[model samples]
Target: MRIESPPPSGIPGIGLRPIERSDRQAWFDYLRLPEVHEHTSWNVHQPEDLDPLFEIHESVSPTSPRRLAIVDLESGRLAGTIGFHTVSDLNRAAEIAYDLAPPYWGRRLATQLCRRVTDWSFETYGFVRVQATVLVGNERSARVLQNSGFAHEGLLRAFRMVRGRPGDFNVYSRLATDPAL
Candidate 1:
């Protein structure tokens, strides 16, 4: 599965498009936000810290992570990013993750983003499962996954290192046979 070019995410009010070079600054800025970084595993202390992401997005392939920029339909500004990582062809599964700018929080855009990408991943790649790991305390993200039709699988105790210390994460998954709400 050599991902040459992905199509637009026909999600209403927002479009999920491939990440571009111009999006680097906006992504960097978003990652710098304390509210945004608090939930993610990456600790981006400087602008240069985002350079690797830019590099990966620049040379994306099917074997590489599929990163898409979630853009607002009205403003055309990047609301956030959502993507599938740790894709396993043998397992027909992948790990999904997303983050939005603080301004876009509580807009329900994250749910839509997750649905579009999850549907796309299953439809496009024949993936049987898509999983998301949300930090235990982040109820908002948990709700986003639930609203998107993902079921809470279980908890991975001290699964990820957030900021610096280890933290528990609630595992969530949506199977291809699951209902799309």
Candidate 2:
């Protein structure tokens, strides 16, 4: 099923959309930037590496992994991507992941996108909990999650492998019962 755009981000001219094949080139351009990849655990190295991620699917399954492109609605530029890395119906939970192009950094765009997506996830999926993880030293990303109302939980030792070696992560969560942002 096609998930409608969550809601207005209130960030004039910036919005979310389902990733399309046409976005592959722009997505590749941003994803390949060294600075963009340094903090996140994106494994993409070449354009072809992202083909699988952009493959068209007829409808979204409840547990299917999803990634939505963040676009500049007015300019039609692919600014970033964000969505759930994992979703679980039985657990009533999901994990959110997102990244922004360097040009868009320091603009509060990530925080706004994160807040809107988290609200949509809870409303659409009836999830009790939404969580995010950031590499230990990624202060910017951690701040994004916190500004989006996610409370820092704790650090997970070697929770994820970035590039190659195991990297420690800080986990954060926002629950349905939490005060609305």
Worst 10-residue lDDT window for candidate 2 reads 52-61
Q: Quantify all predictions' global Cα lDDT against the true fold.
A: 0.82, 0.84
The pairs that clash in candidate 1 are: none
TM-score per candidate, in order? Answer: 0.89, 0.93
Which ranges in model 2 have alpha carbons more than 4 Å from their true place?
Answer: 56-59
**Tens-digit per-residue lDDT, 90-175, candidate 1:** 89899999989888898788887788779888999889999999988888999999999999999999898887799999999999
Give candidates' CA RMSD values in order: 2.1, 1.7
Clashes of 1: 0
What candidate 1 gets wrong by more than 4 Å, as runs, is: 1-12, 59-61
Q: 28-129, model 2: which lDDT tens digit per residue?
A: 888778887788787887788887765532247777666787888888899988888577878989899888888899999999999998898888779899
